[model samples]
Target: MNAPSPFSDMLFEKREEQAILTDLAYANGWMLDVDGCLVKTTKAGGAGGHAIGGAAKLLDWLRRNERKFVICTNASQRTVATYASHLRSIGLDIADHEMMTAATAAGETIARAHPGGRILVVGDEGMLEAIRSAGLEVTPPDASNADAVVVGAADTYSSANLNAACLSIADHGAPLYTSVSSPWFHGGVKRSIAVSSAIAQAIASVTGVQPIVCGKPSRELGESLRLRLSGGNSQIVIVGDAAPAEMRLARGMGAMGVLVLSGATQADELSGLPVDQQPHWVVQDIDELADQLQRVIP
Candidate 1:
């Protein structure tokens, strides 16, 4: 398959004190972004998504080759099990263990920051699932007191829920945790603002407290990815479309970053970037790598 842009189609790797892609098969593990990389999902959490850019063929290859990989998404609207099911329905069969969400990081963060403590949640079932899985208790939406307030994506942003979250933080003098602080996440044509960040900001403004970010570029999810995919310093390659966040994360984790234009990024956005924000390798989309991997990984 031909790449969308010649400038990004190279399969080589070298860095001037910066970066490069690990020869596909050499890396012990891979971290793939979900929404924009493998599939195009609507911003509405859990909305329908379709596999794109040779996604089916590439994922099938990974499974057949027994590649160590994880599908990471910042979407926190559903549980891991639900996400796995959703992805499978879209022709991308992802297992629960191979999936990581911002909610998952939130769970880990809350567990470590406030273990066994009750907290108010402003997200969806997924957020609650992650928190509970980490052995933390969830307080009801109407409850006024809690150890902390956690926010993430939600289908509905009700007044009652907002008030409860505020009270939980104000009454208990609890801290606030948000899955992501990014105002916008890529999705379908009608781009939607990140409800989680909006909620977090509202809570912050009302309570006069700062939020502890728990999404990409945050060490919590990075540590989780390392523990799940990396085996004691084994190489990791991350392929995603988002800028700064995805690339920055890869840099911080000492992993190779590969950007696919098939998702949120465009050619114009890649101009004159700093070394720290540059992707090790740039391809038109997943199919470019798919074409490369077809020749190499097998």
Candidate 2:
């Protein structure tokens, strides 16, 4: 398929980079993003969300091929097992160890920063579990004292919780960590704000401390990916729609960053941006991308 713009044209022309990715997937492995890139937000024309599409087939093929593969997501509300269960429930068919999420990455990063740290976490049971796996304890603000504040998607966020988190961070000189800070994404007709970014902004405004984000473009997720792949950064490929986060991550870890036009970033969004802001290959979606890869890899 032809690229939508000249910026995309330049991105595709870098055959040297493309060769490396094709070689990597053909030889070692590939990493994929779940939302938008693989799963559609809504059922189309009577098909449910669980409908097994081309992307799911690709995932199956990866498993069959026995090449290293992992699902790297910025969604912090779920544990790795929960993410895998959702995939299986939705008919995607993936293993628990095959998933790596920002929630897990953030917990790991915070654990390293403050050893045996007390964490004031805002999220579901999954977030709590991920933190605990990394050797950290979690608590609600008023019930207990904590050494740091960890924010993500939560059903219990409010003015009181925000104020309490800020106070904890301020009093203990604890570092603040957030799983993600993305603004919004399209869903049906309306747009929804990412919970992590909203909570991070609120706490920063009140406490005057910028929370350290450990997902998406951050190295924490990269580290998790590194472990799951076990093939090092040179053989991994990061695919996504957002340039700012995924692209920065690819560059930082010497991985191939492939972007598709199936989600948040429209084709025209790449105009006048530097080369670093573009993907290694711009395609329509995972289906077309898989077809393209067949030609390049073989």
Clashing pairs in 2: none
- The Cα local distance difference test for each model comes to 0.79, 0.71
Candidate 1 error regions (>4 Å): 1-22, 44-46, 188-190
TM-scores for all candidates: the values are 0.87, 0.84
Tens digits of lDDT, candidate 2, 1-298:
9659987778877766677656645746567776667765542111133422567766765776677877777777767887777777777777887777778888888888888988988666667888999998777655334788888776566666676687787776767889887777432222467777888988888779998888888877777677767747447778776677677777777787777677666688877446666676677777777766655643
Candidate 2 weakest lDDT stretch, 10 residues = 43-52
Residue 206, candidate 1: alpha-carbon lDDT: 96
TM-score of 1: 0.87
* Candidate of highest lDDT: 1
Write one digit per residue (lDDT tens) for candidate 1, span 1-298: 9657644444331232222233655677888887677877775333587777687777788888777998888889888888888888877777888888899989988898898999888889989999999999998887778898899888798898888878777777888999998888785233578888888998999989889988886777778788888555878888888776678788888888888887667778888666766887888888887877776656
Report the number of clashing residue pairs per model.
0, 0
